[model samples]
Target: MPRALLRPVWRTLPRRALVAAAAAGLLLAAVPRMQSGPPDPQLGLFALRAAALAFGLGLAFLLDDPARHLTTAVPVRRPVRIGLRVALVLPWAVLCWTTALLLVPAPARPPAGDLTLEAAATAVLALTAAALMTRRTLITEPGVMTSTWLLCTAAAAYLLLPHDRTLLVTPDDPRWQTTHTHWALLLAAATAVGLRACTDPVRARLRPRLSS
Candidate 1:
């Protein structure tokens, strides 16, 4: 496939699709349980987090114009550009993943604290990955700053909802186990995607242009 189309096809679209799939899967998984009665707070939280993940990934894809470098005539430096790009994407990624971490229900049974140190480590890794990808993409196309801000705002609103709080640091409810597992999986996927996006060879060739 042409390099022009490769980014959207491989990186942007696929990531967006993956986010959608994850969200759908979570909702579907929770459906059967909902038939029993009102939706469990834990399950609701999982669904919301999954949706937020999808939105976050989508924002990254939208802000990144994979084809821009191909069209621009200016000769931009690669390293500086890449650094700025990383800086831009990082905040959104961190916001999304951290919010997700805060929103995911924790297990009741733990060795000591409410959340294990291992879990915190995992969360940090996930947040870092998400931030890297998002920053890189946004920095590549600063024109989308307004959109990025909107996304950030929306994510924050979702995270701050009353029900969302119940998901975080809630009592030891059995329903939370499933939600916790899904959160871990989501975090892992975000981390993997972030790493791949940052290391893509195409970025080296794109070069960075200084903001006006």
Candidate 2:
């Protein structure tokens, strides 16, 4: 059943948004490499973070199905359908991030594991927000609103979050480990919430039971 849905789900994805974001992210990641002299570690970090943010912005569109209302009756469960979409896109997203990492000069690269965690957290947060919007509201296309919210929150975090407690810390900072702890926590929380939000509505689930 899932195999059959793959083609259709692939077709439904917001390809334009995804492609644009990937391109933008790759370009940003390449910025450090374009310098005339040896790359700066801090600059590499910034470029990678920007790339992650761009990818997360595109992930905000993952749940947008204009035919969402029409497909409620399909035998495939909502979570399964959502999972399929993620499965389809995961390889590409991973590939892009990998390329982004490689674009940075080895000397300038930050700890890959930690930075990868940050990217994962950002991406999951975006998806969770989109799932929440879809589950809670009548909006068929929640991507733009979710993406905008994520962008604003990122900006605010950069401008307003305190140095001691901020997630945007450098590897040399004492807070680096603590910041990634927060990232892990965020990834866990978003995963839990996103799973819940992807569930079929209670009414939808109860329809057959009530009918019987």
Candidate 3:
């Protein structure tokens, strides 16, 4: 049953769409660099990569619904189908992250040490998003999942990157003070809203009974 569902979901969106969108985002992000400004080119590239991840994830969620499309021909179990969908989506997320890391310029200063905190935070955020995608109930609310994922990723990026006192300029700076305070607040607010929608006890109680 799950296999049956998996086949169509995988085939629903063309690979071209994913690649095109990712590329377009990257190009747009590079615009800042093209102009003669002192913008953090690395940060702009990271933003592009983040956008790609969001786009790919959004496509996966949009196409994963069994109700909108037929699943009778598929031969996989529900759990298996969910697993397969997650497996498929995982690569896209990884690709986005890798692209962002690669495009962004390396730190100007010598490495202070391993970005352990940032790495751990990223791992946590990725796992959380993947878990949400695997759960049938969670995937239904794409907005919540997207918001949660973005918030977590942003937080992780802030914590993981090296901090130079000079580099800490704008709210967009990927350092401790600016990122930890401004971006954290934005992401936290988003996470709170997403969590409220997903885990609201009153809504959860009513949702299952109503659906039944």
RMSD of each: 13.7, 1.1, 8.7
Q: Where's the lowest-lDDT run of ten residues in candidate 3?
A: 108-117
- Please, what is the TM-score per model? 0.31, 0.97, 0.43
Query: lDDT of all the models against the reference?
Result: 0.43, 0.93, 0.45
Error in Å for residue 172 of model 2: 1.2
Residue range 1-212, candidate 1, lDDT tens digits: 23343333334322453355345434533442444554465554444434444444344343354555552333443333333444444464455444444443333123222233323333334334444544465444432353354356446645775663433433366645654565466566756754555443454455432332
- Report lDDT (Cα) of residue 32, candidate 2: 92
lDDT of 2 at 212: 95
Q: Model 3 over residues 55-93: C-alpha lDDT tens digits?
A: 543443332353522342243433354446556766764
Model 2 lDDT tens row, 1-212? 98999999999999989999999999999999998788799999999999999999999998899998887778999899999999999999999999999999998899999999999999999999999998889898899999999999999999998877678999889889988998999899999998999998898899979999
Which is the leading candidate under TM-score? 2
Name the weakest run of 10 consecutive residues (lDDT summed) in model 2. Answer: 158-167
> Could you tell me the TM-score of candidate 3?
0.43
**Per-residue lDDT value at 106 in model 1:** 34
Best by lDDT: 2
